[model samples]
Target: MQVDADSFLSGSSRRWVAHYRKNLDRDWQIPWSSGTALTSGEKQRIAASIAEFQRGEASEAQDYLGKSSAFSTVARDPDFHAASILFVAEENAHAALLLRFMQETAIATRQHSFSDVVFRWLRSIGDLGWSSRVLLIAELIAQDYYPCLRAATNHAALHRICDKIEYDEKAHVRFQTERIARLEAGRSDPAVGLRRGLQSVLLCGAIVVVYLEHRPVLRARLSFGKFATTVLRRNRRAQRAINANRRCM
Candidate 1:
């Protein structure tokens, strides 16, 4: 039931590679201004949110490449291997975009946080499959956050950055989900069902944590109820589509 793995994965890799090469030297910079565009509280909210997200973005794929390399020893597709490389490149590109946003907003990036430490620790202990699932959960949260930020901002520069990041983050979610699906494709029905159940639980927990921690930005854009509504709607819809592909699994 799964799509042809070699074609799907190889094509995806080729597309990503071509895209990366296509934009290799594009020059884009935030339009800087002497005064911060956001008010003090909004600035605080943005700073708080961007700092954590930027930290997360910075380390998104550096650890995964090693695991992908190891997994590829048993798998034959070199393009799949090459795709992981492009995945890292795309994520690091996202990180750079975020750093520019931080600098233009006058918010200094933080090197460390308790959340990041815990995320790194989690990454250290898992295999590539498990680790990517964890990262996908983060992406689900990001898929919500960036769109909300885009809606809340009026500055042309911030708006465009959020727009670009949100677009890429959504694709990142699909890419990771497809990778995980390939691993699940051979599992027994009961096992696949259990995994889907666990995914729902993890997605729910991740949503709560993100909403609670990011209430300021959420409020800047939406009430808590609406934030919950918007994010859960998107996350659940996507998760359902992925889970419903049990036949493929």
Candidate 2:
């Protein structure tokens, strides 16, 4: 699901649909039989770290999908709705994969988490722009988070699961970024600036909360500073691309 810049920037939901359909074909064939290698302490630590994220990923997005009709004018991509459906399905697939890994490792699933609740609320606000922006933050965080999750484990199944999820998340980021840029294409400069400012604040807040919640997993690969810097850097690049897309429109 690692889309190229040209394809991702093309703003063609047809391409997105094709990409998602093709992505669904990847089995990963995770070796569920490769029993976990984690110790009792490791299981407890990772379960606490990953449960919230798994819950967040599983958060239903029926509202977001329904609200996507608002994108008809701004997006105008004939296949946009189909792509959106596929995208949501892909996310749910990630949740299921995580759940399987968790069951294998004796990690319990979370019914709720504070951050997940807040993020779910943000996406339920009946505004496509806000929803896309909020989702983008989660997707960007996953770029770094999944690798850390993989590194934190020696379990083969977990590694493969992380690899699959990380791949899909990259495409999800691109998909959301494209939509956000398109949605803001004709907005006033000050309006765009204001929203971007708010998005920055939101991103920063989410990073702090996530780092606090999953520092053990993240510390496997990135220090706090490194993690923050990486996510911020990606956000800047995404913002620039958004601006670029707006200009072209």
Candidate 3:
């Protein structure tokens, strides 16, 4: 469905942009000392998991800029473009944090992974809203990932990193939800139902793939049942938030 240019940069988007920009300049430095060391097995699992996450973070959507700018202008929110730049910067900063953490822990980052490649592919070729869907998928996984990694590791520095990412992710989910809500809501009633119906299929496949790939790390802390439940829970929450986003209008 085509976005009403006005809906694209709704009041929700403006508030989020300002809220995120405020933190854009804050010092991201965290203490690197390992207060509690990781077990060998834990390190191995975490390193593998984090390397994938680092690669995920190590991107800014240069490809999406032109498309997004066109999207926002038509949406009557040229400022949405700048807002998106800051949003990407924030995500990139997350990549930086993950990279530094990898450096401290001596985790080797790969050139590509099956999951990252597929996710990038999803983000690159689809409508602009598809990228946001991919992002929400990542955030849905992260909603469980960072916190559990923090708990299972017991490393102070790692905890610090997870805390920052977790906080940002909460807002990130909200941001994506708001934008997605705008996009989905702007559609005709039948379009809205159809879009959501299709979204459910896509989301389920992505969730399964992510859970399996990260199974080692996720199993380190959560049983598969627990992890799957958590993913479902967060997914539902995001869907609810998107549905409720009309309040922001």
Candidate 4:
């Protein structure tokens, strides 16, 4: 089933019941398993922050769709198209899950205004055939970011949700990494090398912008400087891996 933000918030219970029947009642192990642990004010603020983050992610996903259409000239390449579609689907799922969680808890939030611009830029970058690479970077970022945020969140319910999301996100990164490797291996043209280099640069730029957009959330929940340093270090590692693999090919 194609899950998006609207459907996720509106139909989460049914979806979970249908797909994860046994796991439904299991005690959520992440930080926010118990809703009662947080004051009403804390719940409201956390919900607002999550809602804003979802808005940004969803905006970027929409932009990716538009950008994919333009990149369809190269869509004859099955790996490229598949990676693009998968990345969008995963992001959509992330947004939907967050929305559903917020609605279930009755958390109030004011939508942020910057979401549109960020997504537009994301969509423009999507056409560069870098979706897989970007997904890899995003996954790496999430590995650190989610854990840090989870530690900072006092609400048990929120922490549990983040834990579940983090688990799914890790799986996503593994899938995308393999896909990227496959795509890179199948390429033969010297021009493809140059394109890959350019795409890496673009992906780095996109990551920076995403980090900047979420700076407030990071700053409030954890040390923004630490988060930024961690993200950059991971990104550099990924770049090195990509370069090394290309050379081996």
Candidate 5:
């Protein structure tokens, strides 16, 4: 029998719904609330990054929901549904927060087309299974990308946002880790293993592409080579950690 939504809305689902409602209702006080000074270029860079992050997050949410729908019969897990809802809601909240921040600061931002970049990256990672893609992307965001963002941002408000984002991202990494473990425990297909390997490669490649594209901006505002090197090193370290943890289990 297909699990009814109402029936599944127990245990974790109930707790998650409560958490989501609280998050939706709570007034998020902007840290670094002062209207601090910033250069036009700095503001532009911040705006662009925020826009890109939101776009990427939306893509992730759509992909997750699509995959979850397909796997629901096999998975039959309410926790998965609840987690997906939480992920989507969080991404939406992030987009809203960024929009509000830009509006409040009076920052004018022109949307630059990054579709080509996104499509090419996705195509390269297309061989990977969805579960692997999730882990690879989460690890990249949590360990490599966010640190670069944190290091590059000088504005107090921006840093505060990034700090909060980084914390959330770390939790996302844990979520991915647990999900992957559950998948591996239940499914042992060689195809799935190969897909995961391909995903890791593609994820690393995408990180390089992002670093290169932002190199000029990063160089001027922050230490260019230093930031890139730190991110790459962190990426490697995170991958190793994930692998080691998996092996121990």
Candidate 6:
């Protein structure tokens, strides 16, 4: 289920709205009763990683609401504003799901992480376009990160939760990538190229930071090179999607 802009962002957001609405009714039936028995090393590694990710998820979309009106106006998609609201709700849902897992597993959540702080700062300083690029970068990282997290722990509940999060994240990246393409469509080639270049640099730095930060869980399934390659590949696909949309326009 590769999510490109055309299939996702056709004039009306009815499909997008319906998609999120459908997900809201989903029942994951995570086995909360199944206790998570982790090795000391696993616990030590995953606790901070989950906490940081949970915090990051919770903090996202706060500013997105404020900027979405401008997005609707610029993109000329009336439903985009409504769709953006649903997007924010879905993000908050992911945060809640992670928090539930953390609570059941006795993993304490964190207040702040260095990566989260920096990412937040980047989001804060930018307009919707820049902020969305940052958000998409995080989603690309999560595309890999969640799979490693599912494999790192033996907990069925965590696996289920990760599956749900991963599922939603794929759609999120697609939605965001399309939205970004529309936003960048009217910009000069050099401007879009420069932003893409900046995204590449940010993506590289983010990969290194996240890999080190969650090395234990990530190492369970991927080496640094493999992880970096996977995320970079996803980023490239998104870049291609944006470019393709621009060409069509």
Clash counts per candidate, in order, are 0, 0, 1, 10, 0, 0
Model 6, 1-249: lDDT tens per residue? 224544455553777788888989999888887766666776787998899999998954668778887777765666878888898888888899899878866899898687788888898787888888998999999999999999987888889989999999999998888778876777999999999999999999999999988998899899999999999999999999888867765
Instruction: Write out the backbone clash pairs for model 5.
Output: none
* Model 5 C-alpha lDDT per residue in residues 25-79, reported as the tens digit of each score: 6554566467665677666665566556545544354555666555544556556
Off by over 4 Å in 3: 1-10, 27-29, 34-37, 246-249
TM-score sort, best first: 2, 6, 3, 1, 5, 4
Write down the TM-score of every candidate. 0.83, 0.92, 0.88, 0.60, 0.69, 0.91
When summed lDDT is taken over every stretch of 10 residues in candidate 6, the lowest stretch is 1-10
5 or 6: which has the higher lDDT? Answer: 6
- The clash number for model 2 is 0
lDDT of 5 at 191: 56
TM-score of candidate 6 against the unseen true structure: 0.91
- In angstroms, the error of model 3 at 82 is 1.4
CA RMSD per model (angstroms): 3.2, 4.2, 3.2, 9.6, 5.6, 3.8
Q: What's model 2's TM-score?
A: 0.92
Q: For candidate 1, give the lDDT of residue 88.
A: 75
So what's the TM-score on candidate 3?
A: 0.88
- Measured with C-alpha atoms, the lDDT of residue 132 in candidate 2 is 90
RMSD of 4: 9.6
In model 1, which runs have C-alpha deviations exceeding 4 angstroms? Answer: 1-9, 19-36, 243-249
lDDT by candidate, in order shown: 0.70, 0.84, 0.76, 0.55, 0.54, 0.85
lDDT of prediction 5: 0.54
- Give the local distance difference test score of model 4: 0.55
True-structure RMSD for candidate 2: 4.2
lDDT of 3: 0.76
**TM-score, prediction 5:** 0.69
Tens-digit lDDT track of model 2 for 43-77: 86688878888887885588888777556544454
